[model samples]
Target chain A: MMKTVKIKKYSGELQDFDMNKLINSLRRSQADENLVQHVARNIVDQVEEGMTTKKIYQMAFNMLKSRSRISASKYNLKKSLMELGSTGFPFEKLVGKLMEFEGFNTQVGVIVQGDCVSHEIDVIAEKENNHYMIECKYHNSQGRFCNVKTPLYVQSRFVDVKQRWKSQVGHDTKLHRGGLYTNTRFTTDAIQYGTCVDLMLVSWDYPPQNSLKARIDKAGLYPLTALATLTKTEKRQLLDKGIVLCKEVYENPILLEQLGINESRQRKILDDSLKLCSAINTLI
Target chain B: MMKTVKIKKYSGELQDFDMNKLINSLRRSQADENLVQHVARNIVDQVEEGMTTKKIYQMAFNMLKSRSRISASKYNLKKSLMELGSTGFPFEKLVGKLMEFEGFNTQVGVIVQGDCVSHEIDVIAEKENNHYMIECKYHNSQGRFCNVKTPLYVQSRFVDVKQRWKSQVGHDTKLHRGGLYTNTRFTTDAIQYGTCVDLMLVSWDYPPQNSLKARIDKAGLYPLTALATLTKTEKRQLLDKGIVLCKEVYENPILLEQLGINESRQRKILDDSLKLCSAINTLI
Candidate 1:
């Protein structure tokens, strides 16, 4: 029988460490079973009571990084999303691209006229006469939840913009919806308010069946920041170039060539991105 | 004839220097005419193209400080408001006190139940069967305007809370109004939207005859941070103690005594506050 170890979560809550959950997460990275088992055994020996989950995650990530870069990258999805930048431009662009892949015609960072004023909607998506004015609330740090004030404000903005949209030509019968997307979690009041207001609330692991993370995994649209083969500087350069998804590198090998990387290194980078885009159960 | 020097504003707009405007501002500080003329002459001689209005104000303020501490404190009203702290707690307290002085029964930082959820209203005031829910938007930096989004969201929160208030006992016929007060300025669009929505808007200098600055002058409720005699640390200590107004210090000198300042320095501080409270046209 193994002793239970209580680990501290980011929200400062304590929970018993589940060895099976750790093993399942490592296995989802598509790492070799032997390597996953070895890492799990090492972590079990080193685990202590009251250790932060973030510290535990770092230990596993470093172990995986030393063995295989692609698996490590796949294991680092949440942190990768956070590194997209604090200004939220890259995150907005990523959200716009994700919506486009979901078969919606999307516009990123457009200024729309409202009933009383104009609003800079983060992403606007339209499909089958259904229009969504989405706002992306990105936080650089953890433990910061989108509070009820967020939905309260976003709902008002959507109402203002919808008022203008309904009065436009040939748009009277279309369904208009407001969406609030964030890389972080939302407070209980925020969720309740958003649900009550009919806001399409999406966070990192919310909504059970279809969250931001689930949507990304389902679409196989891993962000470029997740690639372990790319250095932080290189990832920033790619983001600056408006290339967000791993599929962008897998399809266009010319991007690596333009970055002046050696042929062998480019091949390794391309292989990792290709495997990442095709892998099932990429998110833990 | 003096050469026309272009002065840069905080908004990055360029305008010709008006020496008379500067002179009149100094005069409003209630400084001696000779001191005002001396500062104006020195500023004019040193004025050059593309110097910021901030720099000009700093020069005049330094000159006034060397002569009259009371006048210098009054001249520094805008900057003093900014020093009230970034969290906006002190600003809310000051607003509540100011409203109380205007014959309203005021509550600061209260949580009120809304129609959907609860809201943290900054200040709730009632006078003559009229109820008001006020939200204070405080910015620590210059040039940060309260945009249309601020009023848009404030209006929503007001509507939600107002709905709940209407159902309460004996409150059916009372006039409920929403107010947005800011320490800084507002964009034209913000003013337009707020007025259109019937939200009472007050910023530093908006609604010319009845702005925040105007109310502060009329009520003689200068913040303790406006005193030149106190150090920044001392002002912070007083704010943390919930003693926001200079009138509080003027009426009760023991607050300064408790800060462990000697009698001479306390006398100096009290004298300055008394003069500041009695001065007419303290703002320009």
Candidate 2:
């Protein structure tokens, strides 16, 4: 579903840059050199919905690009969730990581029907005839083991519902089998419940190359535009080695050699990345 | 739609109690008090999903209701939202309030045609035969509304792709209508775009109820079980006198009198609600 946005953004550019952008351009086209920048800031400040970069320029009264300051559009927006602390908790991102590494066959958010909600899981990986329900839970800490009972309660009931519903003569029955995946360990009672319900609790203890460490790095670099932000030399190196994120780029030196960056620029990217790492690290 | 949840809770009694009361009965029946309490806690924690009191007991120990805990099932659920903080930032309850407010209608998340994201508009209003998109930017001080440009920049754009489809004629064309709403004021350019495109922008002022208070309060109550928490004393006033909310109940005491709240209780209700000058005050 997220892919739909990218597809539409491309088509939108072909349609005359959208009316919202056109208006901003018109404003920028009219303003004078010094005033255009001043006006552009003010106009951007006054900007509201249905506004495009075109409308911003038009608002500044500069039809000529040279006449206006800050006349260009912001080409890319890499929402560094690390930099923007308020974005969101990384649970879903972690879920994506877990699924990608384990090769969960289904897309995220697809509800799997099973004997119980615990037996019911987030992503389903079915091949040939055998499949398992994975109940995934993400907890911030072990202290919240008490809270584990609630999710189990839900999963059990959901499994019951699925079983009852499937026993109905006309319903499909294979969908009623899956296991559980949780970030935290279950209590004695929870473990009992999982077993009774035939729920296999998969604890995420950072699975190896298939490990969480590598996947987190890979998921963070899913966007192409963000990779473009690296230095030009770094960019070519990453491209040559197909190293997009700090994780891969750091792990692979061949790519760096291919790009042939000077020691100072390499040091600069590291410094810049360190600052970013500090910011991002604080997010969760 | 939210109203449906409340009305749905009107079963298994409170015995006249409610779903909550019904579950409490199950808790009481357990031979082991500690286990019963732990089970009760699970019910309480997982209540957002509308787990019945019976199910809560079942989760603790299957078919335990044959014991004394049977009575716990009678707690009058009253309303689902009531169990999960009468007014909380949680999504389901927020959805209930948003859907119930006047001029706002939540479509089932689907390929519903609209010019914005599904949950983007905080509140919506109708004006001049168009649905005005609203983004209620709540703050400590009515959010110094110096500009709407950046705010408006975020308004969703719907790209018409029906004609591009192979089954172009088969695709639904009933999407060109519908406006967006926001809690912030629209800029001149935004308003111009709105007028040009038949979209309307409604700004919510800090004294939120200042402008839309009456509309929201009078919008009518949703039937979600969440409403049951108001106590019988509360429900009567809303239904009997057409008082939709506690604010409306306090604002117009004749309804409270009709609900049989003594003048003293009526005053107390009023005192508890004076700060909630608008439905948004209470709704948020």
Candidate 3:
């Protein structure tokens, strides 16, 4: 057997190259198992010792792009989310709109009272008599899970509000609900505890067919980050104006001009958004 | 008007008696405004120039107890909660059990993860598909309200958890909700913010009929603090063993034996619990 090649991680640590990790990541894009394995082998043969994980990812991404654009886009979803912003405000806006699409009256940021204290809730939604307080978890990096403690903490806050309601109001009124919404996945323990406690958990690709990704796809509400033609600044400008979904830009078209993109680029961006919307529609 | 008398507060400061504050408090118990006014005038006439507010409260409580037990119980609710413990752990336990009665599966004193840090959730509850995380803001004094900053901090933790989930799990799981529960009340700002964000707020008599006091009374799950027959240490012992409700002691009379009370007092305690339970049953 040939000697295993050493690779460098983003953290500056060196370790033996792991083929399984790459294969698993590729599989996440829904690439065929045979294609993934072949790509992994080809990338491994071409890899220099001490290559960074980022470099390896780029190489695989490029190779995958040649095979399937849809798979490449799927693979790049996490990276695209990171590009939403450092503060994650853009992600929060996206979540708020998603809730609105789901038919809940949504507010982005507001303060709510508890029995003993006041809290600034990130998002609050109401449907008929039921009220929902949501915490939008946005991440700038991939591979991080909402850990168990988050649910614990969130559950604690909900308990406070519920208790407050019990003390101040008579029992006939409905109890307000609390939920944690994230753009990624939760840890096993988080999922277990969250499920056990009935905390509504929505993470990417979690719960199989009804994840944030699935919901966005179903609603055809892809964020501007999905567009390859748009630059980071253009996406930020659009997001800043509360324009999150690509379909919004696709319909308005004029909004693209506000981003100060050249005529050609604006046309390209709009064209790209149309294609993405259609792609999502076809998938649905 | 007859010469108004100055009274001392628990803080050792002296001030003139305020009839409006007294009337408002009595009104909260659903006392007849005329009766409250008449009672206030009578008490004012009897008050010495340098009597304490505690004395004034006691006089009003005694008079109210004779007039209406429901109002008396409502008035005493805050004081009884304060007596749960100086440390507030006992009260937290009571709140936990109360949540159980309201159809939530409850856990007390758990550590949960947020995106940036881990938090010790005071209470976490689940019902159906909703999880409620609570921060039990138990107070030894009755006047304090949960302030704006507490909710701000709680909301921050929620935001952290949401962000972590986004990073770790590609979006599909629901976000765990948050609440703040206090034995006393929340400030106006807290209420405004909480309502705005849909933070489930439950304070003493906040939402009229469906308050924490109402829930406990409806469930007949009064804490040991509400019992005059038990000493502080005895209450603590029962609380430590997770026996928070007086109804629990009434059903399992042997639990009271653990407190080392003599047979005669045990009979009295049992009788008092029976009376209290019947009173609660009547209210429901």
Candidate 4:
């Protein structure tokens, strides 16, 4: 008989342990300083509406295995996007806000479509006559805005998306207006393009005139949040007032408000709650 | 017509974009992190070994997701693991080493049962009147020894293990001889039991005549490992070489003979890899 060697592989605690107990153990051990645990926490926080605990845990797993190679084929090291703090758990909210600003502020109401394709526009929203496609970039920290793709790529993605939309949505305007939002300022070209299209950019939480981002950071998300006309301090307050209050406050009768929450203040509150609810659901 | 209300919730990123593209973007962002890239790189590493690239990526995906809890879980508003400079990858390999030791040391050529249940045993050879079951515990650090429950669990796991001399095996005292080895002295129970049952609690990789439970920290793994080992620089050198090389050098008697290395040196090397590997893998 041909001789053969056997390979034995040791299984970590998972060999026979319950996953729920394992999660608890992980939550406790998260205090340990390591990349594994940090990513684990991000995955946990991203848990949101309709997500299973199993899927929540799986997010951490998926992130760990993903290879972001600026070109892994060459460098043998996948590029990393962690220069920023945990991308806020409610990533989708940022995209929604940008879409709304692009579509509603203009003549038409925009319908959000497709998830963020990065510079390609996180989502393409449709308005009455024009398509106000938007590219929303979310940053967990102001300094960390250095973490996003180059402005060149952002412009390229937008061009590709715009051209593609012309084929599909027939929004081939000789000139089209689309908004861009990034926590960080745009690369030279992106800024110029915004100027070209009459597209406004909410590059930072702090408006250019007031520098609200710095104040918010110093005062904290709670204090400045209350200062916002639409946003309130209490999560429950937002929940109670609900989107109905938002419509009453923001959506004008002239605009033919279909949304219950039209008021900017009430809408912001509902938006915040919806975001929180999503996070809770995802993590649970 | 009845009145209809379309409410926009203040939620996170969900309504922001097309869900499909969102997944793609997440995947792309994931490739940038080391935790994600390493496994992804390694998964493709075996592509040359006849593993499909897709399978490699998928396996990489599965493996990465498994470590999700280890990646992003943070504490003290800082990274728990990344700051320590320890990636869980090393510990994962440590698990493989622990599982492989016995199979490599099996007296009667190691046989792998590739069935539903898989594991290996050392020294399948029967000893005259007594049938000895050798369970080697190559603890590189801790002085703790397995109690009766250890053998009880292991023996139970041998649901249908075949015995060479089925009747003779029954007659002789079925010695659940545990080969206890560590960098420190065995616990009092382990030492006391050493005299009665077949126990070899030899503290090898520790300081000269140091007590078993000396406070030792996994310094090299200092960031990746949390094992406390003896201050013996020589033993630490073996550990520094990594568990796999240490095992090859330490566990192989022929290699030791050919290398002109003394048995004690080989033994220490083996002890370092065994215990270190076990403790480290457990952390993952």
Give the poorly placed runs of model 2, Cα more than 4 Å off. Answer: A1-89, A92-96, A99-106, A111-121, A146-148, A157-177, A204-284, B1-284
Q: Per-residue lDDT for B1-284 in model 2, tens only?
A: 11112212324433222345544454333235565555555545454444454454444444332332221222211222233322222222233354445444543222322311122334333333333333333221222342423222223222211122223453343333334333335555445444443443344322345322223233423222223224654663354433344445555767657667686666655653442333233445
Per-residue alpha-carbon lDDT of candidate 3 for residues A18-60, written as tens digits (9 for 90 to 100): 8777788887665677888888888878888999999999998
lDDT of 4 by residue, A13-112 (tens): 1222233443443432122335445654565455444444445444544453342111111111001111222433222333354345434432222332
Q: Say which prediction, candidate 2 or candidate 3, comes out ahead on lDDT.
A: 3
**Order of quality (lDDT):** 1, 3, 2, 4
Worst 10 residues of 2 chain B by lDDT: B1-10
lDDT of each: 0.89, 0.38, 0.74, 0.35
TM-score each candidate. 0.88, 0.24, 0.47, 0.25
Fnat, one value per model: 0.59, 0.00, 0.00, 0.00
Error of 3 at B271 (Å): 61
DockQ, all candidates in order: 0.57, 0.01, 0.03, 0.01
The sequence of per-residue lDDT tens digits that candidate 4 reaches over residues B1-284 is 22122222222112221223323322422233565556544543343323332343345445544554222111000111112222333332332233233232224224434112233544342444333333333332222344432332233223223232233436435543334333323444344434333333434323334312111112112212221122234323434554323334435546445545577765654454454323335434
lDDT of 2 at B202: 42
DockQ of 1: 0.57
User: Across residues B31-86, which tens digit of lDDT does each residue of candidate 1 receive?
Assistant: 88999999999999998999999999999999999999987887788899999987
Query: Model 2 over residues A101-166: C-alpha lDDT tens digits?
Result: 455554444544433222223555544443444445556432334233433444433444456556
Pull out the clashing pairs in model 1: none
